[model samples]
Each structure stands twice: as structure tokens, then as C-alpha cells.
Target: MMIKSLLRISTVKVLILLAGLMLMFAIACGGDDDSAGDSAAAPAAEKKAEPTVVPKKSVHEEAEKKDDSAASGAAATATVAAAKKDEPTATAAPVASSKYGGTLNWGTAPNNNHVFFQQYTPGAGAAWAMNIGDPLMAYGKGSEWLEAKSMAESFEVSPDGQTITFKLKKGVKLHDGTDYNAPLHKWNLDWVLNPDNAAVTRPQISAIDKVTAIDDYTLEVHTDRVYTPLLNALGMMGGMPFSREEYESKGEDHLKTYGSSSNGPFMIEEWIQGEKTVFAANPNYHQKDTYPYLDEIVWVEIADEQVRGAALETGQVDVADINSKSTDVIAALRNADDIFEAKGMAGVRLSHHNAARAPFDDIRVRQAAQMAIDRHAWNDILQGGEGHVYMGSVLPPTSAFAYKVDEYMYEYDPEAAKALLEEYAAEKGLTLPLTHMDAFKCTDEQLEIGCTDLEKREITVTVGKGAANAARAEFEAAAFNAVGFEVTMDIAAGKEGPRTFVTKESSFSLRGFGVRPHPAGSMDSYMGYGGYWNNGSYGTSDAQMELHETLKLAGQAFDYQEQVRLYKKCQQIYLEHALGGVKLANAPSYKFWTTDLRYDGYPDFTEVFFPSDTSLKMYGMYLER
Candidate 1:
């Protein structure tokens, strides 16, 4: 899949120096109860960042497309490039923009069995999401938000602000045609949160306590409390509505039952375990005439990103999401006459701290680690100019919520790093060899391609005991090296880290991209909504307690600007406390579409066609020669 941003992804082969991050990091902004509270003190700094409620309704296609176009900023690029008509490359219609859609066969990691809707498959999720679900609101080319129409045409906030009413678009139907009951062709109002339905994602809606339908086109949701972003929250991946009748009856085969029906632009037809998944246009699909211009989209989840790139370069696939870490692949496909590539930065940055025993607990150790990173050197030598430099924090500079701070953040100065380490050691009786740590990562194509590329630049590459014992080994190595103590790392998927080893403070190991809820950009998740962002998931502090209470009432705080202002101030408070974790970099969200297809609605980033987010706006997306 052509993902949204070109994440500095290292195919397990490249050593990611303990992939960790900051406010700019793309943690899950996903709405999980676990992310309900703030943990530790935030680094003394700043930043802030949207909402909604609808019982249920079909999504509007045009608004989605329009918003996508705005996100890509493609139109601006297109208009300018149009002026250079003399150049064939600039004048010719974009190959990717050409219209076509069919069953796309794709592949993904074999064990992606996690059922939580919040936990979406990265590469696989991108291709499947547009077809399977609808986010509350989306931005298109030019970063335009399309909310005037669709499933949630318009909504109203309640008097006490505890309830939100949504005016839906009538005539919405479930793909399976399973309405609430017989003789009553109404949509079942119970499936959204009733875990009794046993739907895999029922837990996500657990917060909604109750649901009421005012009329066919109007839905009302009564929350336990007045959550400001409720409606918009429903538009997210987790908020996707599921049909209770469908799940209740077809519970026997969950995937077959759910996968068989989608009210979106397309319907998935087949899933061949291990090889590929294929998709086809949904005849009854709400946006039928508008969609799937081509007949199908096949995604082959190749573990090896290099192989994926190889496939693209060799024409086996029209396009592929190349790893930013795989410089060779980038170089390979860029030079290939048959292929052309575009590069964008992911918000994800890399940072690790000394959060163990004495020094890291001292903050300066983390400062030293932050300072040791030669920003220019890392990008220049390892990145090969493919990515850019960023400071600690998950709130990217581009986001509207990030509060601009006056501090320099931590910078790369081996001398500064040494000084901080020395100062802390001298003052607190800390020792040398500050335990450097990172999470254990799995070995896949990304690693091979990245390692192969890095090898060209004279960097040492080694596949340390591949995923299994990598975490333990990494921690042991780092801890041991920290003086005579054995320092090493423990590698594991983001999920496993917390359940088993999260609070082992002295023996802490770092992991990347799990601290946030869904997008990882939400104020609650960052400031500690649930356990995440708090003392490493469950760590508690007074500052965090203050922030959590404020976020709850931010809805009534004057206007949207003032509401957001409060969140910003809260972020600064968290920062001053050093919060639970240090964000290294933000991972860019990349969305890839097949070259044979044309549509509008994508995220903000560079796109084959320009939309502010480079997302193809449904209205703007059309197959053109």
C-alpha cells in the first residue's frame, strides 16, 4: 500500500537506536480507557490539539473527498505544474491519478490477530480503513474539513452539554441488510456498544453507556458525562458503528460476517490467509457510482519492504510504500525509469532516556541521551537526506494544537551529553555508562533493506537475536554497559511491553509508539487519560491529576480557541514534570492508493495529486487521462 507519510521505517535490518519519541510522536490518539490519565512530569515545554456524537448514519462521500484534497495540498502543486506544460513529466497526467479499481490483493503480517479496533494494522490498516470504516471527519486536498454532509450531516450540542444529537442522512442501509428486527426495517440501535453482541470491537464503545434514536434520520447519544469531542471521537476508527443484528446472528464467523459487509465505497470479497487480501466494488455501496473506478485492489503484505519495493520497481506492483530507512530501495526505485517516488516526513522522531535506577531517574541522564543524538549527523549519514530533524515531543510543528515553546529542547552535543551525565553523576552520585536502552523489534524486510542500505554507508549492522529475546538482551546489554552493571534491551510488540514489564523501573526497556491512545496526538492521552502517558502507563502524579480534570471540562471553556488554550497550558504543566516518557520524533502518517485508481480524500501530506493533505477529495477525485 502507498502509505501516507514516508516513515523513517527501518526494515528490522537497520538498528533503530531504540525507537522512542516525544510530543510529536504519532502514538494512538485512539480512545482507549487505558489512556485516561497523565503519568509523570512532562519536560518543561508546550503544545495542544477536536470532537462529536451521532447515534449512527452513512458517511458523506463528497465531504471526505474534499477534506482529503485539502490535506494533500495537491491542487496547488497541480496548478503550478500545469504552467510548465512544456515538460512532458509535468504535463502528463499522473499515472497514479489515472482511474481504475479492482480486487487489490495485499499481504500483512500473519499474526495481526489483535481485535481491538484502536489497534489498527499499520500498512494493512491504511488500505482497509477507507473501505471498512469512516472517521468522524476527514480533511482533503488543501486541508479542508468536509462535515456539512454525509452520515453526520449536522449535529447539535445539548443544553447541559452531556448529550449530542446528530441529524443523519436518511436511507442509510447496512451492507447485510440486517435491520433491527423483522416487520421493522429500522437499523438496530443496540450494536454500537452492547458487548453482549460479542463483536470484536464492542469494548471500544463501552464508554457510551446508552444510545437513543430520535427518529430515522436523527440519533441521540447520552454519555455518562459531557465529553467535548464525543461526536468527532465517534468518527474515529474505534467509533465506527457495527450492526448488532449482523454480529448477533453471524457471530459464528466474525471475519466472514463483518468483512463480508461494509457500507463504504468498496466491499471486501476475499481473504486468502498468508498470501493476500482482495477487494471489490460494493454494488450497493453507498457511494457505488463514485467508487472503485477500477474493479479491484489486491494487497500482498510482503514482510520485506525491500521485496515490496523490488516488486514495484519490477512492475509486479504499480506502487509500494518504501521504507525511509531503506536508502538503497529509495535510491533503487528513484533511479528506475519505470518508477518514480515522492518523499514526505513522518512526525515520528527518535529519543531514549535514562529512566532507570539513579541517573535516568535524575532527568539529566535523559538529557544526556537527548544531547548525544547528533541530529544533523543522524540525518546526513544514516538518513541520506531522506528525513528532517525535529525536537522532542509528539505534537508536530504542523499541527494546530502544538503550543510553540521558546526553549531549544535537547540538542545533539556529545560534549553537552557528557557534561549533563557528569554533572548529574557528580551531584547525585550517579555512575558512568548510562544504560542505553530500546525495545526489541521483529526482523522483517524493513530491517533487511535498511541494513543493506546502511551497510553502504559504513555503519555496522547486525540482527540481534531477532524479536524473541531481543528485548531482554537489549536491556541486559545497556544495563551492563552502564558501569560494570550489565545493560541490555528487551524487544517486544507495543502491546506486550506494558502488561508484563511496564513498571520494572530500574530494569526499564524502551519501546516505540504505544504511549498514546489512537493517533497519540490527543490531549488526554498525552497528559494521561488512562494509564498511558502517566508514570509509564500507570505512574501517578499531582500535575497529571490536575490536567485530567481540566480536559474533562474544556468543552465549556468559552470558545474552541479558549478550550484548546486550556489544553495547551495543561501540556506545559505536564512538560515541566517530565511526564512519563520522552518522545523522540513523530511518525508521518502515509496513505497509499493504487496507481490505477482515482478518488479524493486522503490525509495531509504530499500526494500523487495535490490536496492540502494530499488526500483525494471525493468531489475532486475523478479518473482523468
Candidate 2:
């Protein structure tokens, strides 16, 4: 009876201790009488479970916080240097440790016509498209331009400079898993050379007489003459090899909508129209061991320039496109802490006058028009004082073969221009109010006046897009009107001036001339006989013929000094004759990116344009964030 009583008392004491502990736990958890207290404690518990995001402590951070307009240019440059302190300055990957596995968000202009076939599109547009193939050679991989080897392991030109032998890399495969052999290379060359194909790049390689495949890995190229720019032309756009079998089976327009196979470091995964283009890393890439550090690259289309610039500042985008010619844009970028710029190739602005039609067909009129252009005004007003007006022809003033500024002779002299026009009018017995018709619109029978009033003396000038071009068109019209020629402006249907010039749809238009790697490549395309862009028969005059002949001699000369001498002679003749059109100005192009996007392994990172970059710079690039 006593043991039972003791056990009952011990059980009651243990129950009391357990009840006290439960009350203490409830109080710690905020399970009190007040409902607000419980709600606050619940949020505290959830906050502890969330992950933390650590911000990078970079110099760009301090610069971004400071007002950009107040800071001096020296301070801006120093900030850029500091932002790149931990990054590799050279193109090659750094010897230090690297961390990978991130996505790169790039913002760019929209690819209006999304065509993958290089032959159908312009080189700049094609480069912006999904690059799935490799070129024969590429720039930016070496210290100098146009000196890097790509798909071709090695190449040599014969002592005579008429033939070239290329030893292709053996293990390369096309996007469609086809062997990239000599036969494939031969087929591509044949396709381009065929006149029926109407390949846009045919004129660039017109000197090629034949292509012979010695073996699966060896190929030989023979030119009609000593074509020294063969390597540059072959290594540039429209030279990348595609699968013939795929084209034969799937058809030519298949690449317009479908994603093609790629042998490069990255392959197109998906391209949402007007949205974004995604590129996935190639697992079987040739340089898989050390390259393509990013798992994927997402290119977003941001049409608005201001929004694109803001995206970079907010860290929403890694890389972006910035207009290097805009003073406001340049100033804003310089003020921004994290943003940096890499200068690329220069662009030459040209005024194309139709030689096949009236007015421009007259040498006196062409020379007078060329002399009336104010290049300095264009440099100051259109290019924000960042343009080179010393250009003589297709090549920019920066090129080694280009004519010096002092050698240029087309000075702005409206009085002298008027005298030449007056001489032509008096010689032709043409009156001041004589009407000039749009001859291109009329049939052969109605060619005389083309339904135009004979009393009016108006000449139509086709104007391209952009505020600068509009301003130039107005200036040109006023300049022509000052010489007793009534002027009218016709806005171009498309922004493409070359196509309009080739079709002869307009008597006068403004065209953008891209400077080629070699001087001859540009000269042959625009001025050579039977050239793709030589629709107006530019070298028809005896003076122009002399210029063309000099260009040929320059193209064949092996010695650099001899080539320069001949090229200078050609420029002098071109200016004297005013062949093709007026050379306006040369503007610089640039590539912009945030500090987190690192460009390693690209020796000439600032030399080549980003859209058409083929130096395999993307292989060694990575994201630091």
C-alpha cells in the first residue's frame, strides 16, 4: 500500500515539470494572446531561410554613384582602368584561376531580315545572324588585322602570287555533321562564282579563275592575275562554308525560320522573332577544353538606343550597342562608371551619282557637284566632329594605302562649281529653266521629257534615312541650287542605297561604304568592270580607265612601297575625274559592354567590329558576375 502511494506522487511531479517547459516554448515562438505578435514572428522565421546576394566591390561602383557630368575626362578614364583591374588585359585567358557557369545577356539592334545564308544578306547583317560555320581566316586573333588563321590550318601563296594553296584543318565538321573537306570548299567557291547564282560577294572573289581540290584536306586556288587580297576576301564574310547536302534536301529558305547546325563554339538553340536569340555551347567544339566559358549567350533585341544604354547601367544586360558618333551618347557613357568601349572599323560615307543617266553623265557636272560638297560641315554637324574627311575613295584615311589629307583636292568652292556648270550650259545650248526629267521612269518612246514640264529646271536627289543624311540631302540641294540648277528631294523607299544605285531607281543617292581589309577588294567591287556594284559603268571614261589600270598594278605589286605609290596615283586620278561619286566622311564604329563582361584572348579586340567579329573572341570570353 505504501509503494503504490509513492509511485502516484512521482508521476504527478513529472507531469507538472513537462507542462512548465511547453509554456516557455510557446512564448519564444510568439504564440501569445496578440495575433499581430504571431504574424511578425512568422516573417522573421522566413527571412532567415532566404539566400543572400553579395554585390561586387568594384571601382565602377564608386564612379556610378558619382555624377558623371561633374567628373573630368581624366577621372572617367581612371575609373575604366580600375574597373578592369582584376580582368585580363590581353586577348588570351589569364594564368590565374577562373570561375565559369553563367549566362551572358547581350542587347543589340534587331536583325530586320533574319536570313542565315551569307550570300543572300549583307556581311554586317550575316555576322549578326546565328553564326554556325567557320571562315578560312579571321582578324582580332593576332596583333595585326587580317593575320589570324581560322578553318585553314595553314596557307601559302606562290612566288608569282597567282596561285594559293591552303591546308585545311582536318577535324572540322559542319553544323549538319558533314565533313568540312576540300570537296565542300570547292562546291562553295563554284556556287559563288556561278553567274546564275547572283551571289552578292561574287565581285569580291571575281579574280579567282578556278578552285581545284588536290585532296580531302588540300585545296588550290588560281586567280586570273596576281590577286594579293585573295586571303582577305576569302577570310571575310560570304567565305564561310555551309552544308550542300542540307541545302539540297531542306532547300535554300530553310535557314530563314529553322535553326541550322553549327560547328563553332556556340550553336543557335532558339530565335524568337523580335524577341531574343539563344545560343547554346557546343559540347563537341574543337576547343572545348579552354573555351566558351559561358554555358549560353542570350542576345536580346532592344530597338530603342536609350533603353539599350540604360539596360547596361542597371546590370540588366552585359553587352550592348552604342552609337559612337553621338556626342550625348558618348558623354553619357563616359560619365557612367561601369560602361566601357572598344573602337572597331571605320565607315566611309559616299554620294553615288548615276553615270548612265543625264546630268551626272556630263563630266563637268560631276566634277562641279563633287567640288560643291562641304566635308568640314559634314564632319562638324553630322559626325559630332569625329569624322575623317581626308578619305579619297573607298578606303578610309586610316588605311596604309589611303591618300593623305594634303593629297585630297576636292575643296568646297561653290563659285568655281558654278563656273563649270555655266560652261556646260553654254556648250550644250541649254537654258537656265530647261527641265530635266526622271528618265528612269519613262519608256524608250517617251524618254525625251518623261511626261515632265519642259519649263521647270528641277533635278531630283534621292535621300536615305537618318537625320544626318537628311541634313546632307538638304545641303546638297541648296549647293546645287546655288549653281542655277533647281533641286527636288526624293526620299528613298528603303535604307539600302547600294540596291537603289544598282537598280538605277534613283539618279543620285547616299551610300555607306565599308572599308575592306585590303584596298583592292573595295576598289574592284565598286569601280571594276562587270563589278556587282558597278551598275553605272564607273570606269568608262579614259581618265577613269587610267585609274582602274593603276589600281590593277597596285593589286599585283608584291612590294608594299610600290603598292602605296600606285594606289596614290590611282587616288589622284579618281579625284581629277570625280569617278563614281563624292567621298564625304569616315566615322568610327564601337563595341560597348559592362565591366562584368570580359574579353580575353582577343588581341585586336578594339580593331574589329563586334557584329562581324570572326576572331573566335567569344571562345575565350566570360562573365565575371
Q: What is the lDDT of residue 37 in candidate 1?
A: 18
Which window of ten consecutive residues has the lowest lDDT sum in model 1? 452-461
Candidate 1, residue 326: CA error in Å? 1.1
lDDT top scorer = 2
Q: Model 1 over residues 1-625: C-alpha lDDT tens digits?
A: 1111322322321111111111111222211101111222232222321001111221111111111111211122212111212222333445553555433333222433332233443323433555554433332222232342235555555566556565564555555664321112113335434434333223223345666666666666676765544443354444444455555666636644236343555555666655666556555545544554656666565667667776765556654664444567656655555343333334333322223223344455544554454555555544455443543234433333333333435544556556656665566454664433333232364233111111111100111123323532343234223322234333443443322222323233332322221122244543443423233322223445556666655533423333434444454544443444434343332223233333333222233332122222222233343
What is the Cα-based lDDT of residue 130 in candidate 2? 28
Model 2 lDDT, full chain set: 0.54
What are the Cα lDDT values of the candidates?
0.39, 0.54
Error of 1 at 183 (Å): 15
lDDT of 1 at 458: 11
Give me the runs in candidate 1 sitting further than 4 Å from their true place.
Answer: 1-127, 135-149, 180-209, 224-226, 256-260, 338-340, 350-382, 413-486, 492-521, 531-535, 546-550, 553-558, 570-575, 588-597, 601-625
Clashes of 2: 6
Candidate 1 accuracy as lDDT:
0.39
